[model samples]
Target: MPVAFRLPLQVFYEREARHPRQPFLVQPIGGGAVQTLTWGDVGHQARCAAHWLRARELPQGSHIALISKNCAHWIIADLAIWMAGHVSVPLYPNLTADSVTHVLQHSEAVLVFIGKLDDWPTMAPGVPAGVPTISLPLCPAGDFDYRWADLQGCSPIQDDPLPPASALATIIYTSGTTGLPKGVMHSFGALGFAATHGTELFGLGEGDRLLSYLPLCHVAERMFVEMASIYTGQTVYFAESLDTFLTDLRRARPTALFGVPRIWTKFQMGVYARIPGKRLDRLLRLPFIGKRVGHKVLAGLGLDALRIALSGAAPVPEALLRWYQRLGLDVLEVYGMTENCGYSHVCRPGQQKIGWIGLPCPGVEVRIDQAGEVQVRSGATMLGYFKDAQRTAEVLTEDGFLRTGDKGEQDADGRLRLTGRLKEIFKTSKGKYVAPAPIENRLAEHARIEQVCVVGDGLTAPMGLCVLSTVGQPEARHALQDSLERWLEQVNAALDKHERLRQLVVVKDTWAVENGFLTPTLKIKRNVIESTYGPQFQVWSERTEVILWQD
Candidate 1:
């Protein structure tokens, strides 16, 4: 059963009472010793920030924007916002100026917290005039109306009461893959139920360590890293940057680790770079040396202590799941989104499976409608999309079930396997329809391909726009073409006639959030890809060679 949270503020206070001196946050300061903040430290600092908010005299229940990457101060600001009776509006650090502006205007943010960003100059123009901006610690760039120290100068509030369970806690904007982002409003109860339940399910405890590297703006990371730490009184570590991610991970030695499929895939690729996959496969065959090799590999990555390994945000290829399982670390694929408070379903530890998003979580109900839309009615479901009644009505049903636009079916055992998105299916010129997800997952196993987008609209057979992995460089594309063709042929044989990929076009540049090809959550923006490459598809598809190189 989930722990009742009348207000989120109570959770922190309770944790502080239990372990005041325990390190709650371990943050990396560049070129120096890491900074570790205790529970008491966080409590005092957060209280000061809360008092600072009170002095601003903004309207009660005002919206406040938090724009930055993950950090210790981000959590402090979130707690402070709620403590002062204002709802938080977190913005993705990777968001463009247009997106940042839209969220600010849509949420009606009265003030913004700025920290740990590189593109503040570009993002500065988006901020409305006269709206106060407070710069926080670890901010490598930008000047603000108020510094982080200004908040700490105020005396801490002693008797700030916890808000009602029904009070709005946050307005999380979705990382849009196709269009402008939509803000999903969640209550204190909704967020609390998921966090406390997750702590219970994962068996997280005080000694457990967690690495908070993913964007906190995303609900998945927010729940597992921030809320789980608070509810369980666990230690949380922050990554310094991409350069020191390994150092940070090793320092944390997290017992309960969570990542998106992309991060898991990157881990696999990193392993392969150090030790060739073919060689590792050969070694694993030897019963004597195999276990030692796998153990060493995991330990080297600082993941040896990980009791729980989870992946979400995108469909993980079963091959990726088995790759880690061979190392004795099974990746449990979870199913949920921002609308569900990231608590709809989770694969149990020992009963993990490929392709299936395991049983529904406790107090969560999931069912498939006649149209194959996965629907859920859970305590964690968001109240609604903030102020977008029409859009909210489109996704929610009369019976209070949230209509997830994903197409999927439940097995006899109630395991859900998502097929694809309803709107993502495209009809070929041959009058055949194809789902890209399964195909994408299957092809994603190719070691040489970084990302593959299967495009077949108005064509007889689908072709792929692939970005080469670091191993499959542009200069080596010709040498690797034969090997790539062999893999492509094998993938094609396993698919239905219409679903088979005809050709593979290697694009030069990698798809990234900064490049507009991916969302902040690392989801491929299909619309953006189509717009950029749709014009060149016909010319590339007509090539006689099995592989086409854009560069």
Candidate 2:
């Protein structure tokens, strides 16, 4: 199957020409209002902004940084950058001033676009004094050299300039779970191949709707929402804030929804809050009313129309997957990374395995190397890490496979099941190697545990450091302790002697992006968690109790 690479801009131009009045972006404003932009409207704004960018006389292919939460103008700014023959450098909306400065300097970005953000004051200082800044719509109050409103009045660029397929399009920085974020460079061809083929694999097209809530900086959201929308001519809706996420979702009733494991868990918990899990289970057991009841439940949660429910970024628990299945929703697990344009593998609708990421995508080749690491080669593979040849050489093989650090195994059917990160596997004091991800996944099955990290580098056995979920927080301390102790015993019974957890420690502090315990994508920072709790591991292991609460 040969792929015809169509650059995103070219796709956009074609779509705009065919259906200029079709709604492309729906952005939520305050007071339950929304602003809808047609294909023509979006193209006009992007063209106008492109003219503004061209007026600056920056060097061709200059890096321009964009900082924003998901919004209409973020996409506009991205189009403007690309149309002006500049490369985009998108930073996560939630970043510290130091991190902002580091990425800006490292990427050598000459200009920056500031869009919708909650904490502009803290991050504003990171912009160097001389570098120019432009403010997108809904941006926080700031001193910017240019504003979206001002750019909108400029004459739109006359001609549609389609960048070459092989031209550098964007530099997406990793979430930096371990060290400084590395910039992953992607060509227009790479992004185009992924979006074109990926949407085809999922059978998405013009009529499909998507809600864009995830950070557009991440490759998953970029490929799924931004680039996929370009290829498929899908309508995208933006979420306003956390408080109104459900309301926004309900309004859009997206046909395709993508979420990380944490988001899926939160949705499940939200349903549980309205109707207790046991009560819902009993209702679902009724033959006559069960199907309707399930439909009603999903409709209330704004997922009734969802044709494709995708989960990725981290492993979702098998229990969670089964729970959704009972509700008539098949949450497809996708596997990929920043290096592969997030298009390596996906679980097809009817062929999904419980804990496995499905077969390699149409143009993707996957193999398990001698070290048990999953390596992938695809047309969607990135150009390389921006300005980091040494790091690029370290990951990309001589034969062009991107060496994914994840340890995985393939079944006879070629479905990939990831066990753990190669670097995250730790040796216990007894010289037994332990993979924390599987243990953490099992422990996370409990409704009480919102987050868990299994760590015991030099201890007798691994112990779980957990944070309580909303359901667990309201329970009485004694009852919660009893429940956790029972769960711990149940989990241990299924594990080998060396792999069994010694105890479960409930940490008072929640892991969050703000606190540096989690990456922006909500993956636990192992090094941070270990460093924060390493001093007490021995002390906790010495305790005889099956469950321990942090002071």
Best by lDDT: 2
Tens digit of per-residue lDDT, candidate 1, span 1-551: 65454346788888877788999999898884689999999989989999999998988889999998999999999988988889999999877787788999999999999988877888888888888899989885666899989999999999756878788899999998878889999999998878867777878789999999999999999999988888888899999888999988888888988898889888888888888889988887788788898888899999999998888888998888888888888889898989988888889888876779898887888888898889998889999999899999999999999988899988887888899988889888899999888888888888877788888898877888888777566336557788879988999999988898879888877899888898877889999989999998777777787888786
lDDT of 2: 0.92
- Clashing pairs for model 1 are none
Error in Å for residue 17 of model 2: 0.4
Q: What TM-score does prediction 2 earn?
A: 0.98
- Tens digits of per-residue lDDT, candidate 2, 236-291, equal 99999999999999999999999999999998888888888889999888997988
Clashing pairs in 2: none
lDDT of 2 at 309: 97
TM-score of 1: 0.97
* lDDT, model 1: 0.87
